[model samples]
Target: MNYTELKARHRSERENYASNALSLRLHRALSWLNKAEQVEDDDSKFIFLWIAFNSAYAQESGQKHYDTERERYIAFIERLVSLDSEKKLYNLVWSQYSSNIRSILNNQFILADYWRFQSGDIKENAWIEAKNKAMKAAHTALAHNDTTTVLSIILSRLYVLRNQIMHGGATYGSGANRQQLADCSALMFDIVPLFIELMMAGQHQVWGDAAYPLIEH
Candidate 1:
């Protein structure tokens, strides 16, 4: 389910759909996914993939106060898992990428609490406790085939990587983060396409309106 194949499928089927919001989201997400496939740099590839993921999941709150970005995407994951009747996502997690997923979970640099502790905003024990707690929860979720929970935790770590790159927190082409970048990009390369395909398959279900939709003059 690469971009080319997914686009062909969308063109063949999308005409019957009524929601412009989903159409727009798939368009944006697929375009970035196409760009990601062409780029050679790990940082560029990961950032582009994150944008694609964001395009697929992001939505407007339609109110002044909105859910946090974490909440918004976690909710999206819940919807995705519910719609995944064949367990494609769960099998992808458990069968194909379990080791890669475990490595990402254990990387403290990608944990928000680890950074807080590093900055002295939190004590060492607090962040360590938080890290252990998160790992235990993820391990339990994986054992139970909890697709939504495991996917949510994986994306949380990826979001930390996204922030580091998007916010100038990482040195360009730095050797230190290269492995993490490569692993994250590899995971996303498979996952984002499935996400787009899943959304296309479940278009009748309510996916809230995409944020910042297009407007004609």
Candidate 2:
């Protein structure tokens, strides 16, 4: 295809991908939220945010090296809403998508607060700045450069899924990725408890003069 045709095709693909992914993420997020409410562990919720944040960050890297990628998303969304008055779908998509994005930022905010409480050196403003990064990443994906926009759109779609688990009503054994989502949700519940045990073990080793074994001994 010619350059113009190629760009058009590419733009179409990205739009569809973002829509589908955002829809799926909403479903997943809702399920997880349901599960988290029933559970007694706070760590599970935190870990879900952390792992999802990492996942979102990983996907966004695709936009970093591209150009004119961000514009396509803006144009596409504008055109879509203009063509359809079906605000419900748009709201659903945007709510689920933006919510997922915000959840990671929220997670970071919470973690930064905890770290501050524990005497870590993070400043409150610094944490907000760090959280803003995800937004910047999304905006970067929506840049005028077509290439970067495409990549960022995909990353944004992925987070739509992550958001479902964090803020949406999610639950165990509900609809999930079967690998990443299902496994991650299960694993999230266990990580904090597991970490506490590890810390305890390390403390024992320190007192016993175990020499703080080289790596995770």
Candidate 3:
């Protein structure tokens, strides 16, 4: 569902059933998703969309040690995919964004290891071999109808792009990586909404407490 429909549905049905944690997550994520829809600049749009994704998946950790942000989100994706009996996510991965996903996977410029090696941080060009392996694995997963694996790999690539923009690694409005930014932003436009929808549908599952939930003083 689009942002409008999703917002209405949340008010009419989901808000009543959502746990305190899920309610906070959906509200924060949906607000960002709506903001992204009004944005025209690809760079800004991508940033807003990524915030929505982060809002949807971020959780509070009471322990001193916890899963890395990457691991947590990957696990979140696995759960969402498992709950998707309608195969909405599978269809989106296999049919809607396959070519764009391939483009992202093949772009070594976005890979952190590629830059690390170039900067003399590492002696070997291991990222090349790693990238190649990831590409092959992604293609194989696609062929085998393994949507979970495909989505995970695609998310990893997108995470790299996100870091580049958010961490001041990329120039604003530069032509160098315009295509990559556009492609990533477009895919996020679809994926973030679907994620929020799936979270609402699967509210019965434990999503953990949201980080920094609202509290009345």
Best by TM-score: 1
As a whole number from 0 to 100, the lDDT of residue 26 in candidate 3 is 87
Model 2, residue 133: displacement in angstroms?
Answer: 2.7
lDDT of each: 0.87, 0.37, 0.84
Look at candidate 2 and tell me the lDDT of residue 75. Answer: 40
Residue 15, candidate 3: Cα error in Å is 4.3
Error of 2 at 152 (Å): 10
Expressed as tens digits, the lDDT of each residue in 123-185 for candidate 2 is: 667656655665565555434333333324333433434554567535644533334443334
What's model 3's lDDT at 206?
A: 69
The TM-score ranking, best first, is 1, 3, 2
Candidates ranked by lDDT, best first?
A: 1, 3, 2
**Which regions of candidate 3 fall more than 4 Å away from where they truly are?**
63-65, 122-125
Q: After TM-score superposition, what is the CA distance of residue 13 in candidate 1 from its true location, in Å?
A: 1.2
TM-score, candidate number 2: 0.24
